[model samples]
Each structure stands twice: as C-alpha cells, then as structure tokens.
Target: MSAKTATARPDTSKPPKKGSLHHVVQVHYLFTLPILIMYLVFFIVPMFMGIFYSFTDWSGLSSQFNFVGFDNYGKIFQDDDFINALLFNLKYTVALVIGTLVVSLILALLMNQKIPFRTGFRSIFFFPAVLSGITVGLIWNELFLKVVPVFGQTLGIDILSKSMLGNATTAFWAVLIVNLWQGCATPTVLLIAGLQSVPKDLYEAATIDGANAWQRFKAITVPFLLPIINIVIITTTKAGLTIFDYIKALTDGGPNKATRAVGLLIYNDAMQGGKFSYAVAESMILFILVAIVSFFTIKGTSNKEAGDA
Candidate 1:
C-alpha cells in the first residue's frame, strides 16, 4: 500500500488540439466549394463582364469595339420602345401578381375543404406548372387561334373567336391570362401549404364565438397567411419582370411590342439588332429595378409583421 501511494502529476503542458473544429471547418468548406465556384463562374463573372461591356460599344459577335460610356443608357431612356416595354413589364407584374395570388388562394381554400377527389383536383390545378413555359404558351396560342374559333362557331359567339394576340390591348391581356394560367399552379401549391399550416382550432374557436365565415377568414386566415402572400407576390413579380419564354412563344414581343416585357426587350436588342452593349445596359436597369422592388417588398412585409406582432 505504501509503495503504491505515488503522487499523480497533472499533464497541463499544452492546449488540447481542436481536431473537431478543424473537421467542422473542412466539412463546411468542402460543402461550399462547388457552389462558390459555380457562382463565380456563371453569375459573378458574367455580371461584371456585362457591366464592363455596357460601357463599350460591343455588338456581341465582333471583337472590335470602342468605349461609349453612358451613351447606351441614355439612349435606352430616350427610346420610346424601351419606355413602353418597361411600362408593359410593370403592368404585367402588377396584373399577374394580384391575379395569381387571388386565384390561387381561392383554389387553395376550395381544395382544403372536404371535397371529392381532392388529390385529383390538386393535380389538375398543378399540372400546368410542370409544363415548360414555352409549351404552355404555344398550347395557349393554338387554343386562342384555333380552338376558340371552333368553339365559337359551335356556340355562335363572335367574341370567343377573336384573335387574342392581334390587337395591342387584347394581346396584352392574352399574355397576362396565359401567364396567370401557367404560374398560378405553384402559388396554389404554396397557398395550400400555408392554409394547411393554419390552426384548425382557431376556426373552431371562431365558430364557437358566433363568427361568420367571412369574419373568421378576415380576422384569422388573412393575418396568418400574410407571410405566404408576400412570398407569392415577390415570386410573381420577379417572374413577371424576367418573363421571356412565354412572351417569345406567344407574342414574340410583337403586335407593336405592346406585350413586350423587360427580358424580351433585352433579348431582342442583343440577338436581333446586335446591340449587345445596349442590351447590357437595359439588363443593368432591370437588375436594379428588381433589386429595389424585392428589397422594398420584403421590408414592407417585415414592417407589417412587426407592427402586427
């Protein structure tokens, strides 16, 4: 026993190695490297290049070009076509955002009820979102051009057979309608999720308190769904701003460019007229517009939420 009573010494010579910290950092870098590389290569580089080229008179295909400074931007503002196109895009964004939100919310409410074949109805509503935007546009074009006429002939309704893509006013509305049809599906799905997340107990309590359906919805559902509504509006606005495929397919920014949006205008400027620098300037404007809109929309919604809270 006496021989085994040796004093124990503390081993405090060096700090413990942070192997776990190193592992965690390595894991994070490994996970993020690919995405960072992709962003640098695809988005960051192109954006800088576009900005650089915007100051120069580069016609895309040619190597020989000269610096033009703010001339392209000045021309963009002066061009009636550009102004009209921007206005058209703004109108399109407003119309699509409002229409899609309202329609999708209604559909979500209906589907949330105890209806027959709810899954089938959901699928029917969402099927359009699965189709390519160009495909949906083309299909709607045919319907407006061919099927509408046949249906009108059968029913003897002259208004039903009119060329939707012919006149400026009608063409704009036609594109808006097609956009609503194609885009409403995703918003509906989102609204469905939001609706489902809402507490059923709130409705039950409201009913017990002698509240009518409209009062309950106004006081409860709308308040709770505000976040989702904001999301839908932002998504639809961005989509509307950058809309190209459907416009290209359905109207080709035609009928005197009445239905043209910003994306389509940029594409036309770059590809058709060989105005690469001009298009880049237009794109920069668009990017600024989208960034401002998104920031304000999000900030407004956030402020509303804070006020309500």
Candidate 2:
C-alpha cells in the first residue's frame, strides 16, 4: 500500500529557473515595441525637429537659413501684438473654463435625475461634441452675422440689429458662446459618469439620517466625484488655453485683433506672416506655458485629493 501511494504521489522538487523573470520582461517589451516605434517616429522626431528649426530663420518655403538664436524669442516678448494676444487668450481661457464647468455641471445634474426622455436628451446633448470645431464655428458665424440680423429686424430688437462679430468687445463673447455650446458636451458626459458612480446606498443612508439634498451632495457626491472633476478641470483648462479653430473661422482674429488667441497667432505667424522660425519659437513658449500649467494644476489637485482622502 505504501509503495503504491509513493508511486502515485507527484514530485515537488522542481523550482522556477533564474532567467524566467528576464524572459517575461523581454516578452512584455516586445509587446510594446510597436507603440514605442510609433512614438519615436511621430512624436520624438517632430518635437526635436521643431526645436531645432526654431533656432534657425527657417521659413516654411526655405530649406536654407541662418541661425537667429534668441532673436525670435526676444522679438516675441517685445512685440505689443504678442502681449495683447497672450493677455486676451488668458482671459478667454479663464472665461471658457468657468462657463464650461458651470454649464456642464448643471446639465449633468439635470440629466442624472429620474426624468423623461433621458437617453434622448443625452444623445441630443452629446451630438454637438462629434462635430468639428471649424464647422461649428462657421455655422454659428452665419447665424450670428446673417440669420440673427434678419430675425432681429423682424422682431424690432435693435440690440441684435447688427452682427456681434463686427464689434471687438462682443466678438470675443460671441466666439466664447459658440465654444461653450460645442465644448460643454464632453465635460457634461464626464460629469454624468461621475454622478452615476456615486453609491445609491450612501445617499439612502444620508436621507435616512435626515440629511438634506445639498448636504448629501456636499458630503457624499463631491468626495466620490473628485477624480473625475480633476480630469475635467485639467482637460478643459488645456483645451480652453489652446483654442484656435473657432476663433479662426468665426472672426478671423478681428475686429481689430481683439479675439486673436495664441494658437491663431502662431498659425498666422507660420502660414500667413511667413515667419516660420519665429512662429516656432512662439510655439515653444506656448508649449512650455501649457506644460507648466498642466503639471502644476494636476499635481496640486492630486495633492489636495490625497489630503482629503
């Protein structure tokens, strides 16, 4: 019986080989090779080339040019036009971020509740998000410049008698309104996701404990939604700061350059103004500002979250 049992028992003496872990790591690296190659070819190469050409006076059409070093950067700082554009972009981005956040939050809250035609409403809200910025800008431009004027004349509303795009002050707000209408959909979707992720049991418990709606939202909902809110803030802030297409299509950086964003300025410098190298330098500065702002904003928010946790 003992001999039969010994024969039936499996051997347990073998151990894993020393190189097994190394082999596993090598296989994982092989799996990532394609993405690594793509990043190198598309991202790294372009970024290096951009930085290199920024130092030289390389117009878009010319291959040969002398190195201008910091000359372009110096010019950018001294130019009143660049300063005005930068200031304008700062204000525009701030307003856009605030407007988008408020509008998206309100829509998200409304859509999250038990309501009629919820799915249909969500689809309607999200439909605008799939359209291109340039298309939305152009469509709104026509409405503001032509359709509104006609309707205004018919209705006898003198304030809308002319296109807002023709006025420098109102032109910025017009572009902003169009941008918010198109942009808020993404953040609204995100906020809805955040709202849905909140545990119903927690709300029920809060209700049983005599907590009001506002108190429940403050204590239960906000804490759970922090991560998504962080994502929304970072992404929306970045998008707001780099807005270009809408401005280009709507007013073409007019009237009197009041609505010219930094991105449009860069494009004009490279494509229209024929100062490619200078544009490249301006682009580098913009890149740095974005990087710095994104990094700090994300880090600061993350730290606050960690503390709250």
* Model 2 misplaced stretches (Cα beyond 4 Å): 1-31, 60-64, 150-159, 208-210, 304-309
Report lDDT (CA) for all predictions. 0.87, 0.86
The lDDT, on a scale of 0 to 1, for candidate 1 is 0.87
Best by lDDT: 1
When summed lDDT is taken over every stretch of 10 residues in candidate 1, the lowest stretch is 3-12
Which runs in model 1 stand beyond 4 Å of their true positions?
Answer: 1-20, 23-27, 61-64, 153-158, 301-309
lDDT of 2 by residue, 1-309 (tens): 878744542443654453354555678799999999999999999888889888888887776898889888898999988898889888988898889888998999999999999999999999999999999999999999889788879999875678989989889888988999899898899889889988799999999999999999899988877776777778877887788899989999999989888898888887875687888888998899899989988897787677443
By summed lDDT, which 10 consecutive residues of candidate 2 come out lowest? Answer: 9-18
